[model samples]
Target: MTGWCRRVRRFVSGRHPPVPSLLFAAAWAYGVTGLFAALDPLAARWRPGGGTAVAAVTVFLDLLLMRALDDVRDLEHDRRFHPERPLPAGAVRVRDLVVLYAAGSSAVIALNAAWSWRAAVLAAQLAYGAAVLAAHRRWRWPPGDRLLVNLLVSLPAPVLLHAYLYAGYLDASGHGAGWSGAVAVVVAVLAAGYTELAKKITRAPRPGEPAATGPLGLNGSVAVALAAPALSAGLLAARSQAPSAWTPAALLAMVIPAVAGCRFLLGRARRPCAAPALHLLLTFAGYAALGLAR
Candidate 1:
């Protein structure tokens, strides 16, 4: 009902303004594990329990934590240019976000420790958080630092998911090719790097000053950048499964969202009315692309 309350809700939970939806990203991440493992020949041996579930839980938490921090870091800047956001509008308590993020991070690592080897993947991803903080504090910059953080963090999500899946397959069926699985996981890392770059160059706002809302900046380009990998990965995944026929359909599925995401990213700021649906679509494209990479 009130302005501040609306902003806070928008920041912490909603689909527009303050940020994209972390919850959606986490749920999509679960799909990354499911699809990769299901397609693996080792899927026969891949059990649902063991460290695999633990890894899934950790990855989900990590997505939430990282996404929250990104908003926290951008609070001041967004408020100046985009006041509808929770931090800028005073709807969400910025100080409280740290505690929330920490709790999630702790829980993720604890679950990861149960799986031992899998924990390494989590730590690798978590380390990127610290790196981002350092870059922000030490360098007083954003998109570049943000890009590095994205690539670093992205590497682990799919790789770890694949690892857990492949690990289970090895344990149960003893049939998985460890090296081949590792290579597929690496492809995911590369795809994330591309997404990071897209986010960096597209629709990007000026770091300190907000640009008048327009379609030419970092964010807009990012909307398109998200397309590159989503398109490629969808085709690859379809090729893996259907080769001739299904591949085109899969590629189409990937492209349609990308086009919709671009449409949203370009139009949402003006419409505000259509923002939630658009942001949700953008988040879906991002997560699906990552999952497709796996």
Candidate 2:
């Protein structure tokens, strides 16, 4: 039992440090919810409340669950290419993660159920996650070695998470944003994709490592990374009632990733991993500020 506890501690500390992970989840919850409320005509004066708090907690736990499942799903690959990771390095056992996942998922469901019909949305996300896990484990669908294919298959999870947040906001405010909610989802997904691609842009990937640079090459990967955020910012500005006010902030937020890409192209040895994270932080913070101001 003590050994298991130690492993769990090591895994959590290494893979999902609580403070930063919780902060990221909270930012995502508030930022996405705020953006949706602002975009939706019916959600005037929508303020963060108990529902938003619940959503933040739910997102934090759900993200942890996703991390556990992903680590398990990629165990074999990690053993080959990322043996330093917790699971591959024997710092944590699969059953330890299973226990953590079960506890975290139960908390998420209970929190959602107590709050609103957001429980249904949460359930759908969980079901989809389970289905994907099963497909990977049982049928080996979308071959594990194919990074782009796996990415496409996994992209819907974030979209569903964004939808779940929107649903929670609606439940709290008793108002719907009509088409703006859908647009918000698209914007959020694009931001997520941009971050994912940006972090993995490399000229030389380790043997069997799944990176966008593998198929797209360094320049092509960087281009796509730059493009996703630009398109996302454009969509966000187009959807905003005050595009003139918001467009500049969005563009400014984008400069981080652009500069990172430029430095990377100039033959920087270390990847600018921090750039994508900063871009996300700035963009989301800007959106949340704009939404709350309105």
Candidate 3:
């Protein structure tokens, strides 16, 4: 709003009144995911935590470059509500973004070659990125297919989480990471389903035609609830089997925010209001907790 602040925003965004779009991407995807990366090191059995380090590095690259480009595509409509964003306000450095995206892709590919399992992870991420670009091109297509694409595209976080859990568990000489990985898989699917259902409810048909199911209605809510206990169970079992300074505290702490957030989202779905970026707060807190837990 002030002259000095405006100049700073413009300098970073490449135009007047920076859109805060990049900031959003950084906080929501990178910052929080960084936490997952940090915590992931703890979950793994590898010396010095190679998998966790690799995963964190690669994911950050995926988000900044691939996701930010997608954000650019939304400039036309986003301007209405987000006028200060880079694309809408014309402050984002298009050339810089172009370079950053290319660099990120190249870096991930190189890193993928460094690890066996990681190559698969990188592939999945690329697949998701391509899917998003395709979906954006066909945004006006049938809502159901669009929803599916969105769900599939948003799955990298949980997938990465699973990779850590799987490798970590197996490394510890415990049962196959497959057991924990299965839980992660189920959670990923359920989370996507709930979100898709919630979004559907948010953008339902005409007012006259009633929505038989509310946001996160039966299928979605139940699915999320199921993931909660599975994760909590893992945490609790970890604590019970080997009580430690970090295990119990981390296990229990996440429950509060996770439950509260789920409840808050469900309520907000019924009637929405601006809350000064509750998403940023949620993501930061969640990711930080996850990382510190490790």
Candidate achieving the largest TM-score? 2
lDDT of each: 0.49, 0.79, 0.45
| Global Cα RMSD, each model | 7.1, 2.1, 8.0
Which stretches of candidate 2 lie above 4 Å from their native place? 1-3, 208-211
Candidate 3: give the clashing pairs: 13-91, 13-92, 14-91, 15-91, 18-84, 19-84, 19-85, 19-86
* Candidate 2 similarity to native, TM-score: 0.91
lDDT of 1 at 166: 49
Q: Which ten residues in a row have the lowest lDDT in candidate 3?
A: 271-280
Model 3 C-alpha RMSD to native: 8.0
| Model 3 vs. true fold: TM | 0.52
Candidate 1 residue runs with Cα over 4 Å from true position: 1-11, 14-27, 38-56, 91-94, 143-183, 186-227, 234-249, 261-294
Shift of residue 205 alpha carbon in model 3, Å: 16
What C-alpha lDDT, on a 0 to 100 scale, does residue 262 get in candidate 1? 62
Cα lDDT tens digits for candidate 3, 1-294:
254345334534443122354444344333333333333323532232454445455544555555466555555545664567765666554454555555667777787675555566566666556565556657732233344444555666456534533443344333433343454344333433333333333333444433434355644543553354345435433432222453443344344335544565565443122222342334344434444444
> Can you give the TM-score per candidate against the true fold?
0.60, 0.91, 0.52
lDDT score at residue 57, model 3, on the 0-100 scale: 52
For candidate 1, lDDT tens digit of each residue in 1-294? 365445445555642322233444444444444334434543442323444445445555666667667777676666766787656666676655666666666777677565565566566556667576557656565543345444444455455545654454354444636443554454344444344453334233456643432344545545444654564465345424222433342343344345545665665432223333343344334334433443
